[model samples]
Target: MTVLTGEMLIGFSAVRGQAGEQRAFDPATNAEIPAPVFGLGDEAEVERAATLATKAFDAYRTLPLARRAAFLEAIASKLLEIGDALIARAHEETGLPRARLQGELGRTVGQLRLFANEVREGHFLRATIDSALPERTPLPRADLRLMKLPLGPVAVFGASNFPLAFSVAGGDTASALAAGAPVIVKAHGAHLGTSELAGRAIQLAAQETGMPDGTFSLLFGAGRKIGEALVAHPAIKAVGFTGSRQGGLALVRVANARPEPIPVYAEMSSINPVFMLPDALRNRAEAIGRDFADSLTLGAGQFCTNPGLVLAIDGPELQRFLIAASLALVAKQPQTMLTQGIHAAWQDGTRALDALEGVQKIAQGEPVKAQCNAAQAALYVTDAKRFLADGALQDEVFGPASVLVRAKDFSELLEIAERFEGQLTATLQLDSADHDDARALLTVLERKAGRILVNGFPTGVEVSHAMVHGGPFPSTSNAMYTSVGSTAIDRFLRPVCYQDLPDALQHDALKRGNPLALWRRVDGVPLQA
Candidate 1:
């Protein structure tokens, strides 16, 4: 087992950063871990990592596909080998329950193996060949072959809410590596120790698998300084980030200002909305209300897809829902949040909402005298007139706080849905008879959200091939890409065309007789050898 140290992993070497330092905190205990004071990085360290990655880009990207797949598998094995130590550090640093961290660890490893399979599958390369047309009617066409190639070094910003699955060896790292790009991660401040543990696992995996020395690196620092510097580094071709909308937009601005601008795939804010159609609310207001409370409180509502807004008709059913939700919410105890800053932000947002003219405070959980940096679950109500009139109503509270909006009728409900900013998810609690209402909402939701649900909440996001964990503008900087699943590899790749290139000069995938036996399009027709 590796000892906890405050050093950053800069390729094969572990160098202690010379910049200012900080320690991890146990939010649950309201105290610091008192060990392994983490050293923050600055432009100097970013220069070293980015330079090494530039030196290693070709060597890492041109490795045989099978060897690349094996490298990913090795990373998964190394994470598993770390075992309970990783989960324990994550729990202490983030104040997350051990069981939840255990599951997250599994997800972290699972995504690495998933990207491994993706590398072997080879569809992401998008190999295509248009054979030479020597006997065309008027003009002959030259042979053209195209395939996707990895961009250079990528910068990844670790997410605070998901220390394991979206941090050190998380989706961004796994997907970029699968696309054959070198990675540089900026560790989240809240989980420095946990990030170091996972970073060590990746560092060891790279060495053990004969990967290039600078194929991966992890650094720690303030986002404004080290993070923006990393993005502005000429060697970095793209970036992956998950955090506040302000932070994401800041990185985007830096990336665009560079001499050679780069893409930033950032998953930011979202206030996932839930619509209870007339029939569904009438049939099961109590059930929907209880489930809504549970989803709002899950993981302290730290999830990006947390249900922040609820919409329904203002009627007896809506009244029934308020009563049932109030009963469930008020009985729940306050839960420890991730950090002091986040807890304070949630407090500010809730207070501001309560101060709004027409927003009614329906329910609030038990007082938070027992836990440090804890948040009480809360539910509020307002009419569509007030909700649509105030843009502040759309602001994300970032905790277990939600507001319900009562519309006059279905038209007003649709109007409320259309008024939403970009969101990660929009959910519908509908039964068979409510399909027509759901149908009308689906068309608008398709344009408004990345994912839609039927009769379910958005708290649980499945990590699968079909999942789209991204959205437009406020939800993510780039709506075309997903930060999760197999397709995420596309974010770090670009296509290149070879004009009448001889087989001897081509890679195996583009060689004659399909040397690698991968599926390729020849003469515009897909074929497998």
Candidate 2:
């Protein structure tokens, strides 16, 4: 077992926090881990971290792009160095299997390397130039240059579901650092041990790369006070969050209420709806049913992109698919969720679904003997009219449960799609014969979701430039930004334009002669020099 030191990391220094103590629990066993109660952070610590980050922002943001890239690479290297210990601690703290933790660790580091490459590429700057038009018929134009710059310090809240890939040193931190902004993380209480381990790696990386001391910091607290304090701090210019809709909205409100408002990119709730076209359902109902069960039950259905709602046209084919899906769900055994609170919430959600009018519980997964905090898969069905009438049906269940809505015809199915709130992903399971129906549905789905898939599940989100792990409104506070991939750096950046500045006074990427050899839009034409 790795030695546990429950302390707050402010810059390169570890301080014993004065804000109470808390212990981690093993959800699989429903027992608290022995010894090493983690220290919680308080308002003072939040102020200190934010102040230090504000001080470091100027130096850290102005570092040459290559040096910043190296800093990200260094963090990745340090994480790899402690990979074994991280996996073990994560498994113990999260009740997630060793294999899952290993994969998540890989994703965590892979993203860091990807961001390092993005920093080196320098295209994220979005450099543009318009030379002086002194010979214009009406009036002369000033030399203008535009590019993105960092938005000061950022506050990243660790996610409970993903201890590595979405926790400390996760996408938010990686992208913010890649965009030349300092980061201060509010560690998730559910995975304090994992956060500590990852935080140490970041500190070491910053030190080794000669980055500013306050470039990164990690604070711990189980309550909302610390999070609220961090967000309310004037130094935090932006926020990155992934959690329940209620929590995300609360943070957004706090950030807005600050004397100087800031952007809060919160990846909140989403059901990630899937539609089954008629021909496809008739052709491979059983296979699609089986696949749906597998995807819904994956990770005990703790994924943000879990297919919580499925829409299909009512017919004999739909009945066949439901039967196959129910059987597959019934055979599944209960799996442990991340924490007791999460397990309790899952139970509450499923119970509410069962009690809703016009909703029928079709089947439930087998229960494991003496297993604590286990989530049993459940399947439910209701008509499209009833579903559309009841807003409660659209709420995310956040577990191994899915509701299948049976529409009377293609028109009703499209109506259901139109009624849906913003979603992270919307999937269409269609066959060649269903192309016309799919084409009709495409426009509405494009407006409703950030990503639309054909014949695929939404549970597995790929980390790449093309990925958009975001959606409109409640799905995410701002749909224009993504929480994953290289483009995520855009969230922590804001465009700035310089007018009539001398070459020596302008940024290298915007200066004449292209000192940085960057690609930019010069006088409305793309150029590289």
Candidate 3:
């Protein structure tokens, strides 16, 4: 057993909570780092942390937004300063490249900064005051103010693949902290070491910025008990999770079944299917094939946004494109997946695809040893009618695998796209010059996905203001909020409506006089004056 010493165990309060624990390994070397086991947290501890966070929220929420911004800035700086080491450890644990790790680190820091800027501007709080109409024709209207407030403490379940950007100091933690809610991060088992490192960076930032100590807590344990304890805990007002549909749904059911059910923003897995139209397939089948091959194989296809499914109308052009794509994928050696469980899941998925009726394996990947037990990218194809009949075909396989759906005609292709459930992204490969049916397809697809792409793959998720990284149902737990973007802060907050109140009784942002100088539009006119 490789012992974890140094900063790894520091600040982490070890409790007797191991139920079904396993050793996390360095994927590159397949060496055990430490036996990470965590079970249910003590009920008393859960309540205590909740109480502390609630008590802290009253004052913390009232703190100057500038001070809050400073805290976020401090976290961003700490992450950047230790970014190289963090990325190295991440690559060691995840088997991702330095370039990929570097990019994820940038995303993490960029997310922090985005939220910081959002809070600093104070527009996200959405302060609105409908002034009193003391006298009217029938009845008098009273002064009413509405603003968004933090929903007490939040429980964040870190994801396995993105150990940095989606774990510990990931978007959920950063957004929750910025929303004035204390956070308790449930670390991902596969990346516990990385989670701990990021946790310390967060703690250091908190202390340096003088944020409340109980405002953040990092707990580690194994099994479903810890997760059940966290979600079922009454103190946890909302949940943020990024994982499989099974795991995410469990949390949602727990929260929903609670006495006072809370929101669970679970961005469960998706196929992120890409559709190739006849015109585009005929014109640039080879180029699109290369692009899809790269996106599907990138990160060993660990990304939730991985284009696991590709749909196209059946023709010589479609056959040529798919053959070329599968060849490109087969030429690439198998890369390490995020974890053993993920590798197993991917293999199982491959087996299932192989077993499907009318499904034929067009390509299979050969093994290579850069990291842990690896699997190569595989491509499978089936007719659209069969695919539409089998709902299981829509599920995410979670590795370097892509399934091609061959449609008999353009109408069949549209029907397939319409039947797709909620997705993180949906792509349409059409010539820029082709607009009639493609435009109509875009309208239907818009209802099914958060992001729409044209002539591109869906694997690369850009962290930006314009990005909307969530969709309906299984694509995400909530469609109203985004997991990435300036808007992620919305998940951590709830609206508070105030009726005719005295000056002191009103919130500072909604006082008798507008004092925060917050961005406001009054009666369809800018308040710039």
Tens-digit lDDT string for candidate 2 (355-401): 99899999899976788999889999999989989999999999899
Residue 356 C-alpha lDDT in model 3: 92
lDDT (10s digit) by residue, model 3, range 284-398: 9988998899898888889889999998888898878977887787788888777778888988998998899988988876766564658788888899889989998987899
Worst 10 residues of 1 by lDDT: 507-516
* CA displacement after TM-score superposition, residue 144 of candidate 3 (Å): 1.6
Candidate 3 off by > 4 Å: 1-23, 34-48, 368-371, 523-529
Clashing pairs in 3: 38-221, 38-222
What would you estimate as the lDDT of candidate 2? 0.92
Greater-lDDT candidate between 2 and 3: 2
Q: Write the per-residue lDDT of candidate 1 for residues 343-436, one digit (tens) a residue.
A: 9999999999989999988899888897998999989899999999999999999999999999999999999888899999999998888999
TM-score of 3: 0.93
Q: What global local distance difference test value does model 3 have?
A: 0.81
